[model samples]
Target: MTKKPRLAVLLGDPAGVGPEMGVKLLARAENRDAAELLLIAPPSVLAAGEKIAGTKLDVIALRPGDPLRFEAGRITHLVQPEPAGFAKLGECSVPAGQAVLQALTVATELAKHGAVQGILFAPLNKHSLRLAGMDEEDELRFMQQRFEVPGFTCEFNITDQLWTSRVTSHVPLREVADLITQESVGEAVHIIDKALRSAGIARPRIAVSGLNPHAGDGGSIGLEEIEVIAPAVERLKRDGLDASGPWSPDTVFIAARRGDFDAVVSMYHDQGQIAMKLMGFERGVTLHGGLPVPVATSASGSAFDIAGKGIARIDGLQHAFDLCVQIAARA
Candidate 1:
């Protein structure tokens, strides 16, 4: 028999749709086939999800150092519940933040121990991260610190065909001016390079988007294209990456959507996300590149708007799982 791929599934934000969406995904037979799902959540939270998902799930609860409690068609609980926290549905609270952090802590521990093939996170709010006193950096930075991982790490969200990234992430627009340096854009190119290779793309055709309108109108509009962005693209070409552009932000995405490029590297967060979300927001799934182990992607948070409504989509989680499990097989 093919041994199942072990997955560390973290329940982010007990108050939101993480648990509920998790239950919905695990109950699908397809997930069971791809991997063995383990839950890093409090028992009460898993039970609540089971109740909300309308299934009599056999979630096995366990403590640290205990044998994995995994069972077919069930979630193997790996952590003790928080001492006290809110367990409400569809409402965000301070306690909800604490719960999400606790879940991430457990997932990281599993990663450090090499007990699981990948970390599959549900949505976790950035605000929750701050309330938990976790330094409030994005997951890409946090995971790097938590696991002591060396080298650059990046987050990419995949829709049906489009893949995207932020030249600067989780930072202020004011900071963006200073952040758009040759080094920063070069870092993005490298990330796109590594990520494309991981996603099975060879000789990736990378498209670089401009920070200013119409690629700075050939220095007729803005100098950022000439000063910062263009230098990076020149360096990329010299390094032998199939890289090109300082293209018009307006048309680069349309070009990528038409298969002109393998991935599009944008200047900021919304530049890439706005289009990806528009293409198919619910189908938008996230991926982390440059990690030694396959890391399953998810939202920065839970979507309480559809929590317990049985309408929240798990396509993101499903695709993330498929990405990790398939990679695990090759690894």
Candidate 2:
């Protein structure tokens, strides 16, 4: 029998819908059957989530130095210590940030030591992360630093039908063009291709989006396509990757949605994000591509306004967990 992959799961933020979503996800029998989950969160936080989700999980509560076990029909929960001044249920606070950071830190360490094959975290708020002293631009970068990954890395957003990646993310729009180099574009293409394959796509057909209007219109509109993006595509093709384009950003997604490509590599952040969110805001999964250990989370942020409300959606979290399980099993 194939053993289920062990996953280190974290409840993203105490003040947001992350805990509720996590609770709801664990309540499903199929998810438990698919992976051995090591849930990391404070006992109080889990109780609150259960209250909001209206479901009680049969969990094996583990203490320090307990032997980890994978039991059928039960989750193994490692209770995280509550930090000082933890945030309230629906408000962002420094304590919330600190608590999330500590959870992530522990998960990363577990992955580093090969105790777990993957990490699945719920939605996290960047504002709260910033308050917790995350100096990097985003959580992906922070994970890169934590894992000591030296090569190129990017986030891949996935839906049931399509996937998208970006050459540059979390930077100002004005700075995007300057950052779009042939090397960076090639790296983005390669990483997405690799990630798709890791997710079980045999040979991913990657569509590379143009940085400028009309893909430079043959050098009339802009030279980025002619000079930078097109050459990068050619290089990727020559290297035996099934990559094509410098396609117009507007039309690239249309082609992808029409089943022309397996993934689209965009030039900047919003180029792919706006479309992905608009297409499936509730079911999008964000895979931290190129990480040694599979790490994924919901593409959506912590919906603080509806934190304690039982109406919080778990679709994204479900997709995230499923993808993590798939990749971790392959690994």
Candidate 3:
């Protein structure tokens, strides 16, 4: 008999679509059958989600240090002691951020200690985390530091089975040029290739994008493509990773979408993000690639405007959860 993987599911920011989506995700019987889930959140938050979703669920409550047993189609809750302070529906508050931080901390700890094989969390509002006093620029950095993982880590934007990884993420446009070195480009290619294979692809084909317009038009527009990007592609090819690039950014995505490539290695954040979101904003899933344990969430954020209205789509979260389960089972 095949063993079901145990996954940590965190309810992100009670004020947003995370809670409701979490409810919608678990409400489906097929999702429950895919893995053994541990939902980490406060009781009040779950109650609010149930109210919004108009669905009731039974959870086995447990305290810290309790022995966990995996049951297909069942969920166990590690209830937070304090239930107060999460922001009301559709509003951002410090308490909401704090709750998200705490829940993520607990979930990461479980992964670190081998209690869980993968993690699936709902959408989080960056503003809420900043309000909660998060010093890091984003959750990925925080997770990396907390886990003490000493390797390349990246956020891979995936849609329609096509993946994109960036050479530099969350940096200013002015600083992007200087940061696009051979090492950075090579690392992005490496991670994206490994990530695609982990998702069940064999011998992934990768396309690398140029930093300048029209691939620098043979070094007339910019030298970054000639001096940095092209060289990186050649080195990656020598390493036998099935990589090719220095393609013009304008046409690379089009080529990949037409089945020419498996993944695209972008130079910066928006370079690939804008296109992926346009391809299928609602269906995109962001995998926290290069982590020892799989971690993922929606490529989009908490849609506060439509939150708690019982209309927030569960497509993205469903994809995230499904991918997490797939990766965990393989791991």
User: What would the per-residue lDDT of candidate 3 be over residues 1-331, giving only the tens digit for each residue?
Assistant: 1677788998788889888989889888898889888999888888888888999877888887787765556688888755446487788888899888888889889999999999999999878888898887688877887898886789999897899999888878999999999998999999988888888999999999999889899989999988999899999999999998799999999999999999999999999999999999999999998777999998878889988898888888899999999999998
* Candidate 3 residue runs with Cα over 4 Å from true position: 83-86
> Tens digits of per-residue lDDT for model 1 on 1-331?
1577788887667777777777777788778767788878777777777777776556677788888756666667776666366656777567777777777777777777878877887777777667767783676677777788876566777777677776887788888878888988888888878777866787888899999889999889889999989889999999999889888898898988888888889998888888887777776778876666677655434877777776667777777778778766555
Which residue pairs overlap in candidate 3's backbone?
A: none
lDDT for every model? 0.76, 0.90, 0.88
Q: What is the lDDT of candidate 1?
A: 0.76
Across residues 1-331, which tens digit of lDDT does each residue of candidate 2 receive? 1688999989888899998999999999999999899999888888988999999999999875687877887999988887788588777788888888888888898899888999999888888889879999988898899999998899999988699999999989999999999999999999988888887889999999998887878889889998899999999999999999989998888888889999999999999999889889999999999889889999888898898989999899999998999889988
Our tally of clashes for model 3 stands at 0
Candidate 1: list runs displaced more than 4 Å: 1-3, 69-74, 299-301
Q: Please give the TM-score that candidate 1 achieves against the real structure.
A: 0.93
